[model samples]
Target: MVVAGRIHRRHFIIGAAGTAGAVVAIGANGVDAPALAQQTTEPQNGKALPEVVSWKDPDAVIVHTELTVETKRDKIGTSGITPSTELYLRNNLPSPSEEAVANRDSWEVSFEGVQNERTMTVGDLKRLGIETVAAVLQCSGNGRALFDHEASGTQWSTGAAGNLIWSGVPVRTVVEALGGVAAGRAFMTSTGGESLPEGIDPQTVIVERSIPADIAMERAILAWEMNGQPVPLAHGGPLRVVIPGFYGINNVKYVKKVAFTETESDAAIQRTGYRVRPVGVSGAPDQPSMWEMKVKSWVTHPLVDQQSGRIQIFGVAFGGNSAVQRVEVSTDGGQSWREANFVGPDLGSYAWRPFVLPVDLSPGTYTITSRATDASGNVQEEVTEPNHRGYDYSGWRRLAVDVTVT
Candidate 1:
């Protein structure tokens, strides 16, 4: 049930309570035995095989059947905040070593291109101040699974997203301590700490991206905590950037460096990746980079496989850099729409708002859809244009469910 404009926290407790035993068993030695077993599988030819660890959550609804993980829509509202365990995982590279994340307090983030260039340990950051914010962290390719044409990346559906509460100091606070951005720097580039395979050239690998200086000095956060707990390694543990109202890619995880630069980073990930282009468009320069998230909504209840009757339809709506002004639900495709009642208080401009609509229907097949309008007057589109990499799709999402009303 929804309350105070947020999913009731009780729902998450109950859902997690069911798995508490398993969590304890697997976490006995503070190790993921299943993951370790998978990594230790032997090859028939007796050759040493590279370790393969699966980051997929067994309880989550499988969307891409690969690195891209997504939560079950029906389970989304169980908690006001997505539980860290239930949260989706998206990694462009293999998970870093535990040894690297063990000494959380010792993890240092280097700052450059400022008056006082130096490295500050996580402990040093804590002494400055602490702030908290509730925001949504969603993959740019979240709805790629629904694209008419096959997409090359993770085919995530509705579950590749979550609303989370992050605790840390504002990135601007740290920047100010470094004597602020250098005179000519217009961008702040962040890099992750993951190590690559032996043969790969470090230069060819692009794990860093840059954001405009304005954004960095605004709502960006250097978060070390999630849901009141230390951020786990699987979720960018030691330190990560949390840029509210922006796509998850912009919130680089396991951050190691923050560089202020006069020009955008030339890193391949910064220049060539995360661009939205038409099917045949090949170059990054020809496409626009995804920054601010677009206004979007999702219908999470009466899931695609749910039986319908007297149902209460509910889901989430979020606007990038603006408040969600209103939400509309359509029971008959896009033919008709009715305003949905929003539940919960407005967390912030960057947080997702929950909306509910109660409906009575007869036995039949139905197509349900949701659309949102931001306070800035931006409305969600009925259809999203197909792009080459399937990035930044904020189109009205449709849910088809069969009903056997008795």
Candidate 2:
């Protein structure tokens, strides 16, 4: 069988892993509850969801967009790094004018909460330093559609996530050069430069987020390049913020301003939008923010018909911030599992790992799934914890696919 035009070195499993059984409805009080009813949703509103002509991949799934796009699972081959042309698009606002991106070096970004506040051109930042890091760029609402309840917002599936390489100047490097962060800062807030439309309250929809200062200091960077190319206009060119380990919301696209604040930004997106509250509760500042990601893995290949014997199973596994320690795949719906082998070079802990498992099957029906464990020892959850917005769905249940072998 031609598997994405590539083959991997086989690493046999020493033994099988025991199953964790099927997911049953249980509440916080530890009482068995009835299952949440399945929900059906309507297409997103606004202008018709049109194809992104600029994107080279014809097979891309155009979910709901103000330019929102997703990579079809099968297209996410065994490669550890996702290509720039293949990356999913998740724009909150329209791209800046052609004039703004016409020249790459002249784009300006301002820095605040330092001993001195100042603005600099992208060309100027290129002179300070350069660093390259590979990371997962997943939408905060990536697995929304898999939730049993109607959690509102774009209904996304596994396609809404990808791992890519970023090149940029470290946030700490630039901050130190500007005489270091000013005292009393607890949060590092970043803002996008996209122009806001009229009639809407600017505070309600602006793409601004404030993450803990330590997170920003440790892994944040002012990225000018993605997947080795200059940042594109459609994908937050000529500059974006890369906050490794945090959800995509905190890595503001088209980042124009970076400031250190004593409190989180009061923007509605930060205070109310991405907050994770109980299914029926309203979002608030007191609720958990969709900041870091959880451990996730999903089957990607062999999603179609198979002919049984020696078939190879493929999927992706990653910890939101930590390195994945192992991935186990089961053909019997988690009743039994075999550890999978990692394919390709390790792209570092921030990126996802492509995994493969080989098994022989007779003609019949089967349900296949995969579960991941991170370096922190956090195992992928068997079910998503329902939230008001349906943020990150990392469970392997909905990720599984039914297959038939002739």
Candidate 3:
């Protein structure tokens, strides 16, 4: 029973940078069916389908990317959060071989960064103070599937995000063990020659990116197992990079190589695509993408219960660099709101804080919305919050349901 190391704690403020509006607490209100429908619009190019990825059997259905709102609704009653089993899969390339996805063979990962260059198999990685941590891995375009203005790439439903307990070697030790490479200022990750995926654009599939070696060393990891078992091929198998706080694209899968460099390269996903202007800014210059986590929250429990009685509202919040200062809930469509009490104050940034709010329902329809505010006073917005590329960071999530009293 080997366990991976835990994410180190730091003093990161909760919430985002710029925000407006005052925080207020209010009681439940009547629902508006037409208003809710108008707020959520359809994508431009008709309706898109959920792209499914599988390794072993043709029916594996490992991951689905660029999904549409209708597809998400048909699959899961909720959209924002995808289940671990049905988690939409994304790979730089297809599986290297059928055996890699079927056979439960051991794996090996190499560490080549500015400090030191070395290679360690899965067994060796597990022996070095192995630990497991539960964190959220969300695509930068997770909610893009819902945006009225469509992005060129994957039309991901909120389902592009998943929370799993990942196990592997601590990236800090991997970087530190390499005599701490001095020449390179950034860390590069690669995978073995045997495991590259098939049919993927050679240029776009295999991932490689470099961040300040110091930053990568602080939170990087060679993840070998996910959710208490070997990571499925649909996800990254054998090994993957679990860098908390950054977009899912930064966490490269099927890693075969790692390097350290003094200068950043625009060859990888972070350099060219998946990069967007920060929140609240319009037409801002694009910057090299790094793992910048914003304070975000979502409501999961009772997403839409037709047999509604005394429904209990529940969900989780996470901010890698900052702590979730407050999580607020609104049943009146953001016009009025109430603060949902945190499980406690001592929760960690990497760990999610589960919140519970019991609300009594009447014989009518309702819309449940949740918002998060970080310690830095960055409050979640109700709409897109007006970003440059229309990239959605943290915003209010609304769940609709109709009720009838017997």
Candidate 4:
């Protein structure tokens, strides 16, 4: 279906989700998203926010303090899908002017990685094909706060991730329509539309990333719509690249360029930034680029004191690049584990599922944490290794918090 105007939220949820347990599907299928506020008083560096991300729920999302803003963990509710208004914001450069995206049909994105090296407008791309995918968009530095060393970037906790529906033209459809990918190409590099300021090194601050070609061809999309609405400006509007099973950085916002290259782009974001290295070592191309995500899960409910009997433990879990097999809850801090049943519909392999384990408790302080297992048999790491950038801190123990049941 070509995106003519206002795509309904219901179509995507019912069509995209595969039923899991008896629990009803939340997110798009559950209920209408909360309305966005016209005003905000959230502070950033003692002053008011630079700009009002009017589309975002001011009360639900946090601003400043962490690179951009992040969502409150509790606001990242049990709903399998995150509403656009409630999604977190993380950006390297500022969003383009409203004029740039005012006429969505006029927006042009050049395709230079294949035989049909031509530029196509957003309207042109929309006519190609329509597909929907549910995947988790998580910051590569999501668990940075959990790391022992002070990570340089955002101090994101669990709120940095969200499972949402993306409706767009399949990258494969575009590639095939444009005569397929060029030979000798190993990476698919996508560029954001955010304008760069004069004088600064473009390479240092620009947002461009190149991912493995095979993965891009198989799972990437040029998303013009997000969470059932035209992609909002705050969350990358007009169009953005959606690469499932990859970190949030890989999903370039305000995307206007797609290229096939034999080698990874020398773009700083792809070259030195977002690289994982030792605590003392500087990021280099040789070090791993924070691309594929690791299997992980963390408790969202019971963050505070709870009642003694019949309490349900709730959290979100996902298999980074595979299906989540199971999630184990450890009340004794990882000493022992019990399987938890999934409460929402299985949103495919890449998206996270809400899980629950109802347990009766007596008055006492109990530490709680959850571990996830992916279809590949990869279990969530017990502790994160020390790194200079403090990326991918999957240690379940750090997520452990005490809650007194009375």
Candidate 5:
């Protein structure tokens, strides 16, 4: 995949002129300026960084203006598992170096706040055991583009999510073997080893975020594989944390360290970012961090301008921690609804379930909406309150199409 603003190893210093130069000039005693410069200047064996995966069918997805990738609503329901190539990409920072991606085997993950406090390699993790699970990985800010409040972040729609099968060792097993977590630690903060650009202070950068310790020990996995293939560089190769039923932000990619803390991580990404607050409200402690995803569904079969006599509309529904009980489709702007037929076997609680509805219509304009009800009875809201960060939008999915019965 070719990302718009591709950064090469050679370009690190030049690209980060302002930040790198400032860091070099400051040369703080505690900060390792020389090491930072060395990292920036090191050549990647003269090889360019790997290109981030891009959509083969441009029409199949919507490429954000900022290059944050998202699949198109109409192209999503074709398969129960979203293809690795078709999966959306969301990166808080630039991609890691090609060298880093190539030498993944040597990478070690350190675990802290445990009785043993040990480090483990991917091989060690596999030796313990391999477990595969199908789960949804969704951006917290999905559907932000549709919000009327105009939040400041990636303006995503329904395509900012996908259901994929992941293969890895359960986090609980790993933690238990490491002498188990110490008491009083309620959060597990994970960090990636990816190098940062020149100008930014490594300490200030928020590469890590914390999740509840219970969730980490329960449903989280140290995933190294995606859809039977090794995790791609763009999708956090080597290893990543996959927390089923949680938003994607908690699934830290390129994981290097897992620290058990008594309190929530104060990293910028954890504290100041990804919070659900009012448009004007801004502060770390005031806003709540986004966690479990809300029940949501989208119409994917009929393209916006699709023309047909008998249209079959289908989409995927996910209820985060709960199983989706039913999905209802409305043909008349949600004035009424009809239960849609589920199309596939239930993968799991974390995986999305597909639903389809067949409708016959003459030439006219139509608005279609889909709402999902989970086992917990959490129904998709008709409207979601707009937040400052555009996170956790779980409203009824809607689509407008012009049908021509020729």
Candidate 6:
């Protein structure tokens, strides 16, 4: 009960040791806070974390489990940025200046607006077949830290988002090899960005758009490779656009052309300004705009700890079609709740699953909470509905820590 600078709610407890009457009946009863943490550490790979356990009774808690970092290279000058793949290669863009990345030898992939015109290459797209998906490419502002009111271009704090395996060729096999599309229409594509960083202008990089063409030809693709290789160039090299569930600004990068048309090309980045605020609507900041995606989660461990039940609680959860189903947890910050055990095999949709909760705390001063549910029923809403370009998703994410039972 000491809220001055924050971090103080009386703490510590995970039980069954000296059993002072079961730690006062489980501290008068209360425990449960999970659904995130543990995998993302690399003090140069020495690996030696775990020392954060606070308890004075905000509900005594501890969580430490996160370590996942790999390196690829080339995203910018100095190669600066690193926090588990730097927000999935700084959100993607670059490629398509009359395409010619030092000669992939001879590449081609044009397919103009519907019912005619076609073109292909890369060995005729590896013989016009070969598909191999595994999707997950988020960046609809990922979380933009609940927008915080304004000032952004990409300060991205929660590590953007990732998950791959993508192979390529689809957009309903290049809009049925460019000879189909009559009613209603939409599917313009036209990727390629990055070239504006120096002196800006080249028409500010160029990124086209258009959708609905039979749902963007059944979830676009064209991806030339990833998690396998040859797709580097800070990600999205040779060819891009996975669009599985949408986001990552419709997944168009370096792509080149796919058009199909029916008119709806406001040009990528969701029609010019990266858009937001249009879910339920709020003040009147000039309405009308769309491009959904608003569920997010990230807490990667204690970030700093001491002792208690040792500790363990991880992170990673995303949404579009959802599929987390359940993952509740609260260590006395949200009052009470339990259920944090989802290691893998849910594979529902929009990937990004990794969770852990194996604590034995009892030292005091805790605050952690994680909740999720998806599969269309959508249930991650604790409170977050007030847009104006804010773009924050279903809410409720409070994490604090400290412990030392001795």
Relative to the true structure, how large is the alpha-carbon lDDT of every model? 0.72, 0.78, 0.52, 0.79, 0.72, 0.49
Candidate 4 per-residue lDDT, tens place, 1-406, comes to 1122211110111111221221132233333233534455453324344463654555566665433777666565676888766677788888898887689878899998798999999899989989999999998887677666676777777678888899999888999999999999999999888899999998888899999999999999999888777877767888999999999999999888999999998989999988988898987999999999999998876666655677778888999899999999988777899999997789899999888888888988787889999999999977777788878877777777666665
With a 3 Å backbone cut-off (N, CA, C), the pairs that clash in candidate 5 are 1-54, 19-199, 20-199
C-alpha root-mean-square deviation, each candidate: 8.3, 11.8, 12.8, 9.7, 13.6, 19.3
Model 2, CA-based lDDT: 0.78
Record all residue pairs in model 2 with backbone atoms less than 3 Å apart, i.e. clashing. Answer: 65-68
Q: Whole-model lDDT for model 3 versus the true structure?
A: 0.52
What digit string (tens of lDDT, one per residue) describes model 2 on residues 86-154?
567788778887677789889898999989899999999999998999999899999887776787778
Q: Model 4's lDDT to the true fold?
A: 0.79
Clashes of each: 5, 1, 34, 0, 3, 51
- Candidate 2, superposed: residue stretches over 4 Å from native: 1-53
Runs of candidate 5 exceeding 4 Å displacement? 1-50, 54-59, 65-67, 305-308, 397-406
Error of 6 at 375 (Å): 26
Query: What TM-score would candidate 5 get against the native?
Result: 0.84
TM-score for candidate 1: 0.84
The numbered model that scores best in lDDT is 4
- Tens digit of per-residue lDDT, candidate 6, span 252-366: 6666676666665544343545555543344231333334455555445543333566566555555665555666666665568677776655544756565567777788656
Worst 10 residues of 5 by lDDT: 4-13
lDDT of 4 at 310: 76
- Which one wins on TM-score? 4
Quote the lDDT for 214 in model 5.
93
Q: By the TM-score metric, which is better: model 3 or model 4?
A: 4
